[model samples]
Target: MPPGVVSMAEALANVNPDALHSTQTGYVLPEPALFVTSTLQRQRMFLHHWKLLADGFLYMLGQEPQLLRPQDWRAVLEGKMSGYGRTAGLQELIRPALALCDIQTIQGLPVPVDALPQFSLRATQEIIWEVADTSFRFEFCALDKRASGKQWVAAGWAAMALDERHRYVLRTAALMLDWTTHCTRSNTIHRVADRCPWPPSEMQALETAVCEYYTTAFYEYFGRAAVIPMRLDHDAEMEDMEDGEI
Candidate 1:
């Protein structure tokens, strides 16, 4: 394997945490930021690896990695065992997962909204607020009723792609982990709060508070920014890359 595929711990040890935190929108992140950055770097590395493995694995597996069939399990296992596979044409797969990730990386998120068994209308509204809270508008959008959900789906992926700032936050946070104690079992919410910039110990509580705060402020900001009377349209003008509109 090439050196770039090395474990994240080995790849980004010398990265400057202070630089990453400062480089962001003037937020003084805690030490945990390093681990976040490392995680993101690893994801990018894996994404590249996925693309690289596409061809050989597709030929061997007899299908594209992104569209594996039930019978394709054997090939998947074989590829893993052999350390070869690819992720070509995986942007469709990548966008949804990465969008959730970008949000978690920047905002110090909890459970993914998509992972929920179902979404309340209010919950969906809240999610949009959180997405906009970071002002990374392109990361979240709704499907227009006229487009029959197509526009929203496309917009959703586009939003994730256009979110450059969110990506930077993810890369930065990956570096702050001790790698040993960042998990929920190791550190409680209060512990994180006491030691880190944002605190209160329970991870769930932190997630909840952050979500509530962002959601509230996000709607308020949107209300203030609105020029004309408009209903809350989640997925509007998502079909094309409308600059400065997001």
Candidate 2:
């Protein structure tokens, strides 16, 4: 709340405690996991995804295709092809995806991933997206069992929700690189043509190569159901099921 820094207490306060427990049926991080960061990283991650999601939402609205709940549809954004990394333990997996997009830009801060709050959905995306965007040098620690494949590929369907500019692909590329901390602790491979998420007609051109350029370093970190998916109701209005009173 102080300028760019948003506390876990403040971020979690936005969600209903009940919803948090209910949504995380499979895997949920233990309490006291807060991803603190500079105001700049926080703001950077928030605005970057906000603009992307906003654009995707508007594009989908105009296309009038059957839409998926933000959570369900967002899952396609997860998985290995997207460059989402996996750690051996639960705690390490939940670490914040840091910002390495700009090494010079992030001169004083520790990696942004360390400070990400678990339940803030938008915040998580900010973490991942920022990690993807920031261009930095050096490597990050790993969980275990690193991958040999040194390439990257963004999951195909994950980008379906996005626009033609392949914003999600670019963001996913950034995520794979930053999430794995330059492949020090994780084994994220960037294989082209293997993770195509577009229609057949859209394939065979730059789109094919474009889709292969990104990968998910870790999906569950950002898509945990505990962080209630932002809901869109019948009236075309944004509804918060965890409206604080719940």
Candidate 3:
């Protein structure tokens, strides 16, 4: 574990699992559903899922400099790749997030003139329009949707805002998972928390928000079972019951 990263167990010690459950449980499960019968097991499954997402996000942070300082919004909008994005796993992790942004382009590039903000003025904190040598003016904005009862807040240039939003969502999800797992290492969890862009309080709030969002999403995708695998002991119990019946 790196310095400052809190292990998943330590972080999850403070999380309330009941707060992570969803009311809706009628949706169809995705193919190859994860199956867990207990809240603790479900929490573990969630943590494992989040770890995969965190690995993908960290890979992008290290491999794609353009994601942090993108000069060409068009390329990013088109799902352009440089390093880890070329890999199969990372690509699967990132593509859906990138698809959320609405990019308007003409002739394979963004329009030269400034367009309306993708979000409402009330939803934005700051806006920037930079004129490039190509006579194109690039628009970027810092958004604060929290004022309107939304959970996300992020700052970046152009399409990068979408990336920031998705990154925030993933990080918050990871934090929530960390709070739910008891087996995580302390140093590892501390280190993970240390890398977060937001302060501890903010991250906590974001974790609550993201957890709520994902809980609903998980239920919708996996139904009430959430598709986590049953524990070996549970299987043993089932076997015992069958033997007695026979």
Candidate 4:
């Protein structure tokens, strides 16, 4: 009931004990998984199961994408990317993408990504969209010989859904008014972009996608709507899954 934090007991109380196991058939069941942060710890069990498909047809011989760069995505989910790191606010979050796009701004603009947020939004777009699709629910249930590739894809959306700061900044960016974005300190400025890089609907969709997967994860792992402590055997299973040996 708190503003930001949801305790495990509160999270559990929301889940229906008698709900059908939806992992087998997907989470189209009546009782949906609670969309809260309580799944944060439990979801780690399937952190290895996250992934994406490139161009909708880039999957080769059924091989999934590799998690080449997971540092930024991992750091935030683990609560490591919040404070000042080289740049203040969320500038650190979008710094890597800036380099990729060759878009150089001042040394430390208050929110460089704020001006054109797509540079940051594109970081997690395709992969999150894929994993959230119902098709991969079973794939996550199975892992190939390479599993690390999908971590960042899942991590990208999880950061948006789970981290308070990350979600707040993203939602704020989406709600920015046209005048607000174009204005100077005092007077209104000339025209900016005809439209923002990305739309608010994208933010809503990302949250919806992750929240659905968050619920599906509970059913897939716990076999019930409940989220309890994962056992040692499950931990070992997750370790093995991470190695793509599963």
Candidate 5:
């Protein structure tokens, strides 16, 4: 394999926790963040490996690394993994899993949330409050609908080109991870405080939190401002991107 793939493969091989325990639900990985700076890098690598890298980061957050197939996220997050519970009962994702970690505290969060091309400060702020909120009064039925009026869709890349989607999600995930690192396994995703679940499932939510750690790796290589930003309208713009509107 070429050096880039070799190094990335090696890095993925190195993404394990400090220790293991039957008593533990998940662990905080201590490795630095590993953000990918260019769309070329992603285009070169195999998608499954990229996904494993994604899952590995999720595992670092004490979440179900199986983002597409979340099984024990709620039980683990809610502290019910030790006993029998329903995996499909509350199929929503929250944030902050644990183990050894290369932490990026929320204190140094960048001023420009518009760095990631497809993301908006408004959307980021909305989810931050949504995930942080602990009240049933504002409870959402699904992760996709958790944000405002289904207007600011988190997965707004549905119609974007594959390459564009990869670039957008990667950077957006990184920026979010950087800002929310302070809340890892230490926040209010508690059982009684409130019940906030991500639509589709908790996998997307957990996936967002987990990306924080891996995005650090990108910063180590390319500073934090690498992911370019752009303003977009969900219905009008994203659809246009698919039709080569941009």
Candidate 6:
């Protein structure tokens, strides 16, 4: 045995087989005294032991159906293990049964949607918003107070008006915000915002360039920015990047 691995016999001994059996099959199958350990190796041993128990349960159902009863088999097949209920852990134990029998294709037993993990739209939106807000704040600090205040107001309105359905557009805007913020922070040639003499038109041009760069990034990440609605489009100065334009 490896340093971090336990044997199947050892794992089976620690846990009550009756409890394990009851969790898997409605009826208490069998119990025997066993040894147990609290090591990472025990996880491997546990999985292997579970495989043996699942195999034996199926075999019993085939040979002595009367002993197990039909409802008990139905509960197992439907992922409704006794004490475990219909949890992911129980589902893992029953994977063999799911594979052996085409439980999915069978008329009434649809797989549970929550059984699989999925990416969340809300979480993605929150990330985009964080990136956008950070970028806006960083860039706003580079301008004179009056212009900075106006830009701050505009940025806040833009963030507030952002539509949940247009996350891709929000992502593009965030990328542009990051680019402008980085450029402003790194430009040592100009005096700091309080003393800098850069005019409003120059600042506006810089913002325009950032928007252009954002369009290129958007096209590279997603095939086309035009797929997003016209109302959400910000880079009006540049032509839309068609498919394969990158």
User: lDDT: which candidate is best?
Assistant: 6
**Descending-lDDT candidate ranking:** 6, 4, 3, 2, 5, 1
**Mind giving the per-residue lDDT tens digits that candidate 2 earns over 34-108?**
223355455443334333333333333233223233333222122111223321231122212111121222122
- CA RMSD for every model? 21.5, 18.9, 22.6, 22.6, 20.9, 24.6
Q: List residue ranges in candidate 3 displaced over 4 A.
A: 1-196, 225-246
Model 4 lDDT tens row, 170-236:
3322222111111111111111123344354554444333233334344434354422211121222
Report the C-alpha lDDT of model 1 over 1-246, residue by residue, as the tens digit.
Answer: 111111222213323343221211111111111111234333233233323333343233222223233223222212232222442333333233334333222122222434223323433333333323322222122111121323332222122222342332222232212222211222232344244443223434443332222222222322211110012234433433234221
Alpha-carbon lDDT, every model: 0.26, 0.28, 0.29, 0.29, 0.27, 0.31
What would the TM-scores of all predictions be?
0.17, 0.19, 0.18, 0.20, 0.18, 0.18
Number of clashes recorded per candidate? 34, 35, 27, 3, 23, 2
Could you tell me which 10 consecutive residues in candidate 3 have the lowest summed lDDT?
A: 133-142
What is candidate 4's TM-score against the reference? 0.20
TM-score of 1: 0.17
Residue 145, model 1: lDDT of: 18
lDDT of model 6 at residue 10? 31
Error of 4 at 140 (Å): 11
Better lDDT candidate (3, 5) = 3
lDDT of 6 by residue, 1-246 (tens): 111111212322233323211122222221110112354343223323333244444443443222232344344433345344444354544444445654432233323443222323332232223323332332223222222223332232123233432332223233333332211222322222233344444543433333443333323322222111112123323544443321
Whole-model lDDT, candidate 3? 0.29
* lDDT of prediction 6: 0.31
Q: Write the per-residue lDDT of candidate 5 for residues 1-246, one digit (tens) a residue.
A: 111112223433443332211122221221111212244233222121222233434443342332222234323322232223463332233223211222222222221333212323333222222222211111111122321224332342222343464444333333332232222321322221243323334433433433333323333322221121122223332432323111
Off by over 4 Å in 6: 1-198, 226-246
Question: 220 in model 3: Cα distance from truth in Å?
Answer: 1.8
Best-fitting candidate, scored by TM-score: 4
Q: Please identify model 1 stretches exceeding 4 Å from their true place.
A: 1-193, 197-201, 224-246
